[model samples]
Target chain A: MTGVLTVVGLGPGDARWLTPAASEALASATDLVGYGPYVDRVPGTPGQGRHSSDNRVEVDRARFALDLAARGARVAVVSGGDPGVFAMAAAVFEAVENGDPAWRNLDIRVEPGITAMLAAAARVGAPLGGDFCVMSLSDNLKPWEVVEARLRAAVAADFVVALYNPISSARPWQLGAAFKIVSEIRAPDTPVILARAVGRPDERIRTEPLSQVEAASADMSTIVIIGASTTRLIGRAEGEAPYVYTPRFYGVRP
Target chain B: MTGVLTVVGLGPGDARWLTPAASEALASATDLVGYGPYVDRVPGTPGQGRHSSDNRVEVDRARFALDLAARGARVAVVSGGDPGVFAMAAAVFEAVENGDPAWRNLDIRVEPGITAMLAAAARVGAPLGGDFCVMSLSDNLKPWEVVEARLRAAVAADFVVALYNPISSARPWQLGAAFKIVSEIRAPDTPVILARAVGRPDERIRTEPLSQVEAASADMSTIVIIGASTTRLIGRAEGEAPYVYTPRFYGVRP
Candidate 1:
């Protein structure tokens, strides 16, 4: 009996952003596995077994799901945002490449979901409307040198930069370091967006100039967007949030 | 009788990829406006009106939507993929910033959707799992020199690159030009993915080595992805497609 392992993305936060495919995948899953919070988001399906673990042990969780699938259990590995973007899809493939050889033959599929940057970008207007770069500031997997080099190149290339995993208690200064690099290469008044828990009830979205951006406000839930040379902020009425966007016309304004 | 203009993304193509928020917006919209094909994808609602036009007339379509909203009509400007990513969201915002001052005060919201690159990446096993850049190769709006410089910088930084609008009838030579630049900075054996019309019935996904990629295989519906230095392709059984992923460890095997 060939079992199936479908990795699912739960979108950023809201059920409204969830795709029908992901919702259906979750509904039909006999076994669900993922980080505690992501798995908790899915409503209980009677008789469906749930296996939740810490996000740090991605490979172990992946292996456990693969093991279940290999034993004829249809499993779904849930992830926040699109599984392919700094999420569970890569981890599952890594497990397959290095784990039991027979595991490679199992049916595996990844269902895409709305990523944080897109959801966050929507709330603040179209800040990622043009060419852009997405990078994780977390240095747990790679050296900080790699992040610095990539940031410099993206800025030079004039791609709007979206930074994931911006800061955590362990590496609080990383966001500031990124801002310092951006300050050097781009204009001080360029638009900056900090969107925290965008789709959830406690969602907060703010727009500030690159020079005065409040880096300390960002948490694990925050996604930071640094505008390119052409990124702009359109002012609205008093007490109203500004609309942030990067025009498709490249260096020119509307 | 203040009206609302909601910019909604319809994902790549399939209804399964469509989000509930987009569906609700489409259903409630008094007027729908977009490129002819994208607008046609939305199921017609009784008493609802649609304004479809050529893809080239983005700003004009945006203005029409704004005009409808300003006249107390609930309007939805439909777009393929996340409206923020090289789609209609920026165009609408551009229209607002330049059109009428009163347009800025009208209630405008952008609902996000799964962009093409993410959908394409998911089907190919997470080629965009790590640091990445999204760029459009069309030189219609921006100069070719800008595209050339950005491509060079993106490759030098070892960021996985997802190129949109890779080729169109008017810009037949651009994709080849980009390939030449990429070949100079990266290994020829780098993985390349050609995902055309993902999620749609006619979707076709093909992977190749950078040196052997068929530039002519792409059309306007296609999205081209070039792997980074650490990206790998895991071979499967005969006739089975391989899984391509960039590990989170960055330049290191898991």
Candidate 2:
């Protein structure tokens, strides 16, 4: 039996945000593999073996999934948010490209899901309504200079910036550096969103101006969004959360 | 009776890709409003009234949805893909911001879904497997010069660029101009993906080198992806579709 390997996104932390396609892939898999937290999110199924590993072991986990599929076990490699965005889909492809040549013949597919940025955007009323750039703040994969340069370019182009992996225990100062770079170029009144554990019960979304935003507010579970020049706030009645959005209209200059 | 206005995403063209949160919003809606094509995508309910409109009337459609909800109708404003990204969520928020203050008091929520780029990226391997930028080529909202400058900035930053609204019937040359701007800075071998009608029955995905990519190949339904400098093609055995991906590991030159 030629078993299939599927990479599926679980979507932020909400079960309701999970796509039916990804749900079906997980339900039908004989084995599931992913980071421990993501694997824990999947509903338990009878006869399905779960292989959960620690964070930062994406390639190893992907290789394990590929090996399971090669040995005739239907496997699903899962990730939080869309698998294709800084997640398991790329790692699976990398394993296939560099690992055993026979892994190429195995059926592999990526099932998309609602990414964290989209989920955060929805919760906060479309801060990413215009052109945007998504970048990882962690310099583990790339140089810090690349991150700084990309942030500068995004700001110069006036794109709303969605930052993932903004701050971690090991890389606590990167978010501050990023903020310093962006705050220098953007207006003081430009909106910045710090969304933590989006879609989860403990989800916290804070929207502040570029001048007042504190980089120390972000953590590993947080995703930060820096609004473009066009981003604005809709005033709320007393005690209500204000609606934040970047208008679709541009160039006319409000 | 206070009613709710929920803006939901239909997720590319596949019903299976729709999130449960969005599906629930649709099922509970007494009225639906969107562009004709997207409104048609929602499953018709016996009691649900569908209000379809022409394109480019986003604000008008949003107003209609808000009005329906204000008068005690549970209205769902739908968009293709995640409403937060270049879609209906911003329009809805704009209406609420500029419209009656009473509209602010009504219950409003955004239900996120799988955006087109994620769906297209999943279908074509992980072309956006790293840091990327998303921009729309339509000059309807922003200036052509802004688009050109943004494209140049994205190329300079070496971002995998995803171009939405690549070509419309009225704006056929924008994609070509975008292509010209990027090709001038990037390597000739960089990959360019034209994903048309992604997740639909008539979907077509073509991967070509930046040098050979024709801007005329794209249409309103297409989302074009330009790979970063680090993107690579995985060699496939005969008769197999090529796998394109950007590795998770960066800074180490290929």
Candidate 3:
């Protein structure tokens, strides 16, 4: 009665963004595990056991799901964005790899989903047209020294940034600190984009001077920060959406 | 015989990433116009019209498509990834917006597609999980001074970077110069990611120190640069692929 485990990405927010493959994986699962909010995203039906909890307990939840699978329950561990991108996929894998070897034989499949970075990039046009990097601001697991070092390195490298988990109640100052590091290397006018709850209702995305990011309502659910080389504040008239973009090899324009 | 112009995104190189909506848009179009390489990506068909050309002539080619649409050919202005992201979608709109008034009313639909950034991120296992930035090193359309200023600004801000068009035959040194800017403000040992031909059969993605980038076989087709803020180089043992990720939030388990 050994059950298999499949980790799925629900995509940014819209159910339309859900891939058929992901749906099929979840449908075949006897139980689903994820953040309580993310659990609501699964298509509800009878006969599917759901395990939902607060966000802070990802590792514990992942372990719980693995336990179910170890007990032979077909399980699906889901995440809002791509399962691998700052989601539950990696945790599930880590738990399995480090846990008892008995669970290693369980069939594990990872289905990729659209991440917030790409979705937000699309929503705001093409600021991410080229080589860009995404980074989180929270420093609970990693040392702040490490975060600052990377920020300095990234800023010095002139990469456009997509910031995730930019600000939370306990860690509000960290984002501002990161902003200062980038500001030292970038101009005051560099565009800092704030994409809130991308692809979800109540989503808000706006671009402002890099110096003003601290003033924005950056929160646990918010993705914030600046664009690097090649990013520009596109005029609103370019399309229905006002966005930022790093022009890619434009001189070759025919 | 007014023809409609539809812009579609072919998700990150994998066929699985293609959104159903994007697939439907491509199927509905009578003809496809795009860069030669991108045009080849359209799924196989016996009679679909594919107008392909070199990458150098994208603007001319896109404009030509608009003219064809005006002449009543239902043309699909296809670009690899998303059209709006440094691709030809906006160029198409710009051409039409400034073109003859008779061409203004044609139905133009812009469908979101998978961009390279997402494909690269997925391959690397969430290098862009949090706050990040993207930039290009090409100095053809904009002056190097402008590019430098933007780079400096981004550096000051500590954003993770995605570099598009990092090097080419005409501008091989541009990326190096950008690296110099990054080095000015960052540590020499900071992690830099090089993702080549992402999503293609020849895909190569690796993370190394900032100084090693010049020695790498980065070319016009390469996407290069560093992560900022919280990004760190995970051990190669994480998987066959290397990853750089910023910690998620202030208090999440690794």
Candidate that would win on TM-score: 1
Candidate-wise lDDT, in order = 0.92, 0.91, 0.69
Query: What overall lDDT, based on C-alpha atoms, would model 1 receive against the true structure?
Result: 0.92
Indicate which candidate wins on DockQ: 1
The TM-score each candidate achieves on chain A is: 0.98, 0.98, 0.93
Q: CA lDDT of A104 in candidate 1? A: 81
lDDT value, residue B115 of candidate 2: 91
Instruction: Please identify model 1 stretches exceeding 4 Å from their true place.
Output: A252-254, B252-254
- DockQ-based class of model 1: medium
Candidate 1 vs candidate 3: the DockQ winner is 1
RMSD list, candidates in order? 1.1, 1.4, 5.9
State the TM-score of the second chain for every model: 0.98, 0.97, 0.89
**Candidate 3 lDDT tens digits, B13-73:** 6666677767776776778888776678787455778898888676678688888888887
Candidate 3: clashing residue pairs, number: 48
The list of candidate 2 runs beyond 4 A from truth reads none
Per-candidate TM-score against the hidden true structure: 0.99, 0.98, 0.71
